[model samples]
Target: MIPYEEIKVPVAGGELAAVRWPAGDPDAPVVVALHGITANALSWGPVARLLAGRVTLVAPDLRGRAGSSGLPGPYGIAAHADDIAALTEALGLDRVVLAGHSMGAFVAVVAAVRHPERFGPLLLVDGGIGFPAPTHLSPDELMTAVIGPAMDRLSMTFADRAAYRAFWQAHPAFAGAWSDEVDAYIQRDLTGGEPAMHSTCRIEAVRTDGIGLFDEEVLSAVRKLPVEATLLWAARGLMDEEQGLYDEKRLAAADLDGTRLEPVAVRDVNHYTVLTGDRGGREIADRLVAYARA
Candidate 1:
């Protein structure tokens, strides 16, 4: 397995942890990958492995997931975008190819617009476009509507890592795509030991960010996006159904500045496996490498 360097970035509440995977070339370009709302930096492991020795890839734990979960509130897409901006600034990167999966993709768009000078091109995976909100719903209702199963899993506790694996093993998304990397992602998310093996993602963090997922802030950012961005969405929905997250017709209808946004549909896989499975992960890694080189 490829290794990574852990870093702590100072933000408003506390420190945000980041992981840097060396791409084996001193002159290689830098690429920063962001995880989904409930995922951590390790969510990019499969992608990192595929791109090893190609470019220096970095993944931040964001504000409230895994190693950085303990950081205080003031969480949201805008806050997370600022954290990314602060992180890139602290690392002294004038510009980086920013790639974000799921909610992270939304964060990338906001960051790109807010700090255009910090990024070159954007690689969005399974997110950033479909702000499909059922009108006038509460935050809880919004979370249930947008990310039901994923949102529900946050509060559920498992007996052990084995059980946790079993829960996901039965998930339709990983039907035939489960791998050691996925096991690592699952294991890393488990905290509180055996008796109370709970997800490390903070509940409050999820609540705060869940509300932002359907907010106009992200949509506004996408509308005003100034740089080139490409979205790669899966063929299946979050529950591994035939329908996917971003509807083609809906996305096509949205007034996403054509000059700034491009959407690519990825065949096979669902929300979870899009970046954690072998084929989808490599596809994303390849795109990220291409983005870095361009």
Candidate 2:
């Protein structure tokens, strides 16, 4: 079975809950893995398995998501990066290898730039590079066009865990890719009583963090990345769309006149299953292991 300890890292006025998946040896290297805006710490489980003997992965339930959902946030990308910086400092970690998925990548970018000394090479999964700045679009518009049905889940109430899993089962990304890990991940997303279950992620936080992605902090960090980083994009988009969130054209365009951002494409996975799928998660974990050894 996958092994981990749920711990609360002190942040802001309170504490931030995290999934601490240990490495085989006590002396094994460490990496701080951040999940997507609406996701929780457990979302890192699949990938953690592959890095089990090589790296200790600490995945945080960023403020306003899951266990940290109730934390009062002056929420935004800035707050997230600050929280991460605080988490790293509180843990007494040095030369942190910060890996962030989706919106978490954007938060990592801000954190790397905000606290350059503390961060080592970054593994930015599917974000922090592609964007239309907030100056170009409203957060509401960004949310509707980008997150789409995912935002609808905030208002949706599932009658039971199976019902909630049913909702995710219908999602195109998972189509035939669902497994016990995915089931557990989706089931944990539910809250309230058996008769009425809702997502633990606060919609306001999603809205704020979603818009925060387009903010200057992210854009500025992109223009001047503080350290070496890798961008691993999923071949498919959020809805299993033909077009992924970032295509080769946008990636190429992003490269010219900007800091060098290494990019890799993971075939056949969408944003949601990038880490949930075995192939993609193993690939990401292998790279992370290599990063630790380097």
Candidate 3:
């Protein structure tokens, strides 16, 4: 695994705990990565390792999750977008290849729209395109249906770090794709002592952000992006189901206009493995390196 360092980034409410993988060269291209709603910076570990010093990667634990869980929120996609903008400024990054996975893809869209000058090419993994909100279901039900186990874990406690690892080990998506990088990512989300440990993700934050996924601003934010974006979608669902998040029919329905946003299908991976597995991580890292170099 490539070496990385932990750092703190000043954002709106408080400092955002982050991880940085240096590229050694001062002039190396930089990629600012964003994790999913209930995920932390360590989720990018696999991709970082695959990059192999090609580009510097900075991934942050957005407010209300993991190391930044203590930070107050006003949490949602838009709020996270603002914090991302702040992160670039704090680090003196005038332009960066902005990449996001899952919910982070939503945040990337809003951030690019809000601060176009700060971003270059956008790499959206397994998310960013908007899904039609169901009207029959209430907000809570909708969240449970969409977020599934990720949201459910927020309210559950584990006996220890080992227990937390076991929970993720059993997830269908991670069954055959588990690795040391995946384990580290899982362990980073744990908080509190043994017998009472739980995910650092805040329920309120997940609820608000899950709701924001369907917001008009978020749904339409992609249309307003200043730069081109490449969306990498998994072939399987979150639970390793046959149908993944974005298929040709779904992408066609979204009406991307085939100009600014390009959707590419990644086979044999799920939402989680698309960032954690070797195949998916290599694909994503290659694109990031190419874009950053461009």
Candidate 4:
């Protein structure tokens, strides 16, 4: 495993738990990464390893997830965006490469727009663009429908860490893509003692942020990105389904005309693997290196 350090980033109410993979060179570019709604900072482990110390990688467990779970909410995409901006300022970073995956992509979009001067190019992995949701469903129902099992897992109690690992082992998305990095990512989400362990993600935070996926704030932000963004979409979806989240049809409907977003399809990887699997991690790492060097 690549060496990393866990640190706390001071935000409004409390500290956001984060991990840093230091670059070999002190002046190397920095990439500030964000994780999915139910995921923690460790979710970026695979990509961090792939980077091989070429550039500094910093990933935060956004408020209400993992180490930041104690941080009170007002949690939503906008709140998370503001936290990211503050994080950059606190770290003394001018403009850094911004990247997000899943729900994180949404956060990244809002951050870049609200604080455009804080970020360079964006790397959106399988998220950011808003898709239509069923209008009849309530906020909770909408989250259940869109996020599916990930939301369900938030309320579950596990027998042990092994049980939680088994739970994810059964997920279709990780069928053949499981690795040490993936295992480490999931392990970090567990909390409490044996026979009663549960995920560290706060349900309120997930619910609030999940609703923001369809909010106009996110869509408007996507349409107003100040820097160029490369969207890396997976071939498969959250559950390794045939239809991935964003396709040409959905892209055409989003009307990305005035934005600097470019869509790039990544083959043979599902939504989860797009950041965890070797192929996906390498692709993302390559772009990060190029962007960092440029």
Candidate 5:
């Protein structure tokens, strides 16, 4: 079985929760895993387990989610990056690999660029590099497009935790990905009971924190950092033709100039399963281990 221990590090004015998966030594190369929006550190379990005794793995729940909930802030990418940096300082960690998944990847990129001395390398699982920033849309239109239907889960109060969980299962993103392992992970972050299940995530906090507010700043700084990095994106989900992260022309034009960027595409994974599903996580873990060793 994978071995881990609970760890709490102070960040800003509140404490953030993390799971520390120890390697053979304290001085070993450390890797900090940052989860996405609506997800906590546990989401990295499969990947962390695969690393085993090779490298130390520290996964944080991030502010406004899980044990880090209720921290006051804008919760934007910059804030998340700050909180992460704070956590590192609080724990007295230095020169570690920072790997972030999904939204967390966005934060990781910003953090590595903003605080180059704190991280050795950067690994972005599905999202880290610069992308198109909306120029024609207002804030309201942006929120609507960004949140889409997931906003309902944030705005509505569930009768009980069960109902919320059931609602999540109905989401197209997770239609066929739920299994006993997935269910257990989901159950850990839910509240209420009986007729409904509500997510422990603070919706307003997420909306405010989840938006990408530092695209230009991050992009400008990306070329300055000497951090080795790679991005492993799913073949489907946000990149699918129906709702891609970019238009074909835009995607082709976007590049990580002056930075070492490697791309890996998982054949059949989507946004959600790319981190949670067995095959997807396993593939990521393999890459992470190889990257860390190199």
Candidate 6:
């Protein structure tokens, strides 16, 4: 049986929603799985099922994402890291296996470094240490090029759940990778409003948090984490040219001596789907369990 429980965790000066799945025994080692931007705890459903019998899985909706609400400003990597630390402390957990996808990966890396005493290992799925592209274009041009339909999504409203689902179905990001798990994820992230399903994530949070993100200071700090660490990245091109996180050369330069690097060559999987796709989920979860055991 899949042990599922909802938990309210206080962190970073606010309370967040978290789900902990005790895999067979509560005494098993815990793995904290964090989702990427625009995703919530449900993103880990597929992976969680695969590891359900081995490790206790703790998945939390980061502040301002999904059920975790009422957060103040300064919603950057540091803030998210603090939230993780607070959640672990509030739950009385230690020696955890830290894992994250995409933006969530960066958050986990920062948190593990900031609170090295609390975790034993780190597994980064498709992100961490650095991201690609800085986007030298103007803000308007950058938004149009990168965010695409999301710009319209920010202003437009969905008449019903169906409409919202349809919008997601047509989105380029999905690229025919949609599944029941992905569908459920979109549903939970949108709210029914007068004429549309609106996203709960604050637009300002994206603009402010993504701005001025990444630097040598951040990379240096992450390299100092006191635990086993591994990075599982998709071979497909995902990081933009400006982010500096996806470059094979740069990633090689990030070598911290003994950090394991695994390139997931699974078919048709890209940066986004590495953590969101079904096949990728199983692969990531299995690797995470192995990392946790180490």
How do the residues 1-294 of candidate 2 rate in per-residue lDDT, one tens digit apiece?
Answer: 397888888888688888888888988888999988777887788998877668999989899888788788789998999999988898888878999998889888889989998888899888878565555656687788768888888988888988888888999999999888788777667789978889999888899888777666677687677788888999889888878988889887676355756888998889978888888899889888888778
**Candidate 4 stretches greater than 4 Å from native:** none
Give the Å error, residue 64, model 3: 0.3
In model 6, the runs with Cα more than 4 Å from the true position are 1-3, 131-152, 237-247, 253-267
Runs off by more than 4 Å, candidate 5: 1-3, 24-28, 192-197, 238-250
C-alpha lDDT of candidate 1 relative to the true structure = 0.86
Candidate lDDT (C-alpha), each? 0.86, 0.84, 0.91, 0.91, 0.72, 0.71
Deviation (Å) of 288 in candidate 5:
1.8
- Global Cα lDDT for candidate 6: 0.71
Q: What clash count does candidate 5 reach?
A: 12
lDDT of 1 by residue, 213-294 (tens): 7678787777777788888889888888988887677676776655588888888778888899877888898888888887
Clashing pairs in 2: none
lDDT (C-alpha) at residue 47 in model 3: 98
Query: What is the per-residue lDDT of model 5 for residues 1-294, given as tens digits with 9 covering 90 to 100?
Result: 366898888777778888888988766667789987777888787777667677888888787777677666667888888888988888787877788887788888788877877877787887765654478877656656655665555556677656656866887777777765566556656765654556778876777654554356655555565687877777667323244343335444765555676666676777777887777888877767776676
lDDT of 3 by residue, 1-294 (tens): 567899898888789888999997878988999999888999999999999889999999999989899999899999999999888888889879999999999999989998988888899999999977999999999998878878888989999988898899999998888888888888999999979999899899999999989999999899888999999999999999999988999899899894489999999899988999999999999999999999
Candidate 4 pairs with clashing backbones: none
Task: In angstroms, give how far residue 88 of model 4 lies from its true place.
Answer: 0.7
Per-model TM values vs. the true structure = 0.95, 0.96, 0.98, 0.98, 0.86, 0.85
Q: Tell me which residue pairs clash in candidate 1.
A: none
Clashes of 1: 0
Candidate 5, position 266, lDDT: 71
Task: Encode model 4's per-residue lDDT on 1-294: one tens digit a residue.
Answer: 588998887898988788999999998889999999899988899999999989999999999988898999899999999999989988988778999999999999999999988998999999998877788999889998878999989989999988988899999999988888888899999999988999999999999999888888886788788999999999999999999998888888889887899999999999999999999999999999998778
